[model samples]
Target: MVNLEGKGGMKREGQRSLLEKAIEIILFVGALSSIIIVFLIIAYMSLEAYPALNLDFLLGWFWDPKKEMFGIFQIIVSTLYVGVGAILITTAIGVPTAIFLAEFCPRNVRNVIKPSIELLVGIPTIVLGFFGLMVVIPFIRDNFGGWGTSVLAGWMILAIMSLPHVISISEDALRAVPNSYKEAALALGATRWQTVKKVLLPYAKTGILASVLLALGRVMGETMAVTMVIGNPRVAWIPTSILDRAKVLTSTILLDWSYVEIPSMHYHSLFGIGLVLFFIVALIDVTATYMVKRGVIK
Candidate 1:
């Protein structure tokens, strides 16, 4: 009986050690796999874009494919134009909605609103594109004559698509502010509006800024919805007005994909655009990290 009890205890210890080892191995594998995947993607992009890397390729305005030429200037300008515009719109609408939800909305109202925003996030990209094409495109065409399929249309659609992410993240950030801060402000004779603008906003600025950067990243990579509404014009400058048609990086890739031959420079150019996009996202992420580390964000 003494021998059996000792053996049973040994088996239990062995099982526990095995389980711990297995978990450690699994976690290490997962982390290593993620790093490997990211590195492989960067490596592939670099290899493909290397051939076309030059001052001319980056600065040239012309993108004539028939002559086997490509330039990213126009695409870059359009990307910034659309991205900035979408960010502005999303901030204006999303931030206010977040403030309302976090500070003023009743619990019952919040339950409904939160679920609706969640639903919006759950909707697929293709469905959003279709909705934009069917509803937004026509509305712009009818009300804003001569602005058919223009940057304004794309900006509006993208702003709508970006709303859920901005609102959800910003709301979370705002709510993370300590209740004591608000109570202290109120006790100090500050009005609710003043307290929100002066205290809460300052405390939550980092989170709000991060949310905006994240939204910008989403707008930059967005293809389907923007492609449908942007009209895909072959312009080389930022659109002077909302009514002007513009060509963003994503639209250019999709528009030229079918026409480019295999192993061609145009094919390489697509990869180059992808590289540019990757770098843009990386820059945003890095900036956000820096801000967080610097104690700029609460």
Candidate 2:
């Protein structure tokens, strides 16, 4: 009987091992497939965009293919402006809110605030655009005096749209600091703010920066929400102020790419913008990572 029981146990163990191996194989294939898809996308965009890609072509602000002007520098600038605006706003509101929630707020209050903030992420971008269009834009136009669809409105929209991500990620980073570290700081006669600023913030630098990077990517890629409020136009020069209608690269693609005849300069030009956008985002990510690493080391 004992031998029979041992045999059954060995059979079950073998089955478990086989199952684990199968799961590992499945996971490996899934990862490999994602990598392949990413490479394929990059290759495809580069191939499509290479024709119109030029150093001089990208330096100007005009995009009329009929006149052979395809300068995207202003569009790039606008995109950067909107992104940086969103980042500044998000960092200001989201980081402080995160700190409050993570360090100061009561558990009951946090439970309410956290979920409410997260719900913003679920709201449709189009709807957010409408809210910007109806409420934020009107308020801006009435109060600040430009056409309601100013960069400030777009910045406000993006900031609101991105809050959940910033707050959630930053709060998690703050929360992840070991209690012992905080306790040590307190024991060393450090104030609460000092402990948080010197110890917790430094310790959780990676996650806070990760949140910023994530928001940066979202702000750069966001279409409906930003486009609706940016008052997009093909500018002849760089925008003089945040109130000047901001035409972003992604909006330019979404608004005009469908009707362009195939095998045309316009079509290829959009692709070129796409390539530039890819490189721009990649560069931002790389720069942010470098900065984070440097800060952590210091």
Candidate 3:
């Protein structure tokens, strides 16, 4: 006996199975393509930069391309210095604001403030750079005394630029914590503050840390804003003080790339600088992912 209904059902199931396999193949291809693209970029940059990369390239302190002085030690140091300073400032301010928004703010007020913070993220970086150039630089020079464009200026601009990322990510982490944990703490006679301190923060620390890492990457890679306000010292030197003029790696590349002959060592060296930055940001991302995965148990 031919069962027409069973045949029809089998046909539908076969069709659905084929569709599922197609979707899986598409996703697999997408993932493979991304990995392949990344490798291609790294390979291209490495080949281009190989001629200029060496111990001297990594450790030399001066960077005058005309004379082929391509030591980027000071530039690397300044990049780290400004990035660390910005991360510190952003983490300090952003984490607390995130906590308040997640745990304490009234709904209406949270609505207003969170959107405003997100909006700040949308403002063009060039506009921020111009603002720092026109206003922040002069204010710093008048009040704090060095060249208006200083490591301090870079820190301030980067910190502002990084704040929205830290706050939004940190707040989501906090909010994602199981509400039952909070309720449980309160039922056990812990105060609200204690619950937040002892329970919420520990649970959310991984997310908060991830946010800071993301901000660090953003600050390190910022070009125009840091370039505008960082003094871009004529002679690259490790900044000894916050008020000292300094030039970071991104600024160096941005300032010099256009002027360098495409086939020259100077041009290759700039790509090397980019390669170094790529490794740094990749390390941060990997570390963040590892820590967050490990932290899931905690």
In order, what lDDT does every prediction score?
Answer: 0.85, 0.83, 0.90
Least accurate 10 contiguous residues by lDDT in model 3: 1-10
Give me the overall lDDT of model 1: 0.85
Per residue, candidate 1 scores C-alpha lDDT tens digits across 16-77 of: 78999999999999989989999999999889888887877788788777877688887898
Candidate 1 RMSD computed on C-alpha atoms after optimal superposition onto the true structure: 2.8
- For 165-212, candidate 2 gives per-residue lDDT tens digits of 989988888988889999999999999889889998988888788789
Better of 2 and 3 by TM-score: 3
Pairs of residues clashing in candidate 2: none
Q: How big is the RMSD of model 3?
A: 3.2
Greater-lDDT candidate between 1 and 2: 1
Q: Best by lDDT, which number?
A: 3
lDDT of residue 294 for candidate 2: 75
lDDT for each residue of candidate 3 in 1-298, tens digit (9 for 90 to 100)? 2335887878887888899999999999998998999999999999999999999999997888878899999888889999999899999999999999998999999999999988887668898899999999999999999888898888888888899989998999999999999999999999888999999999998989988997898789888899999988667888898889998889888989768898998999999999999998889888888887887767
List the candidates ranked by TM-score, beginning with the highest: 1, 3, 2
Q: Show where candidate 1 strays beyond 4 Å.
A: 1-23, 234-237, 293-298
**Candidate 1 Cα deviation (angstroms), residue 20:** 4.8
Which consecutive 10 residues in model 2 have the weakest lDDT in total? 1-10
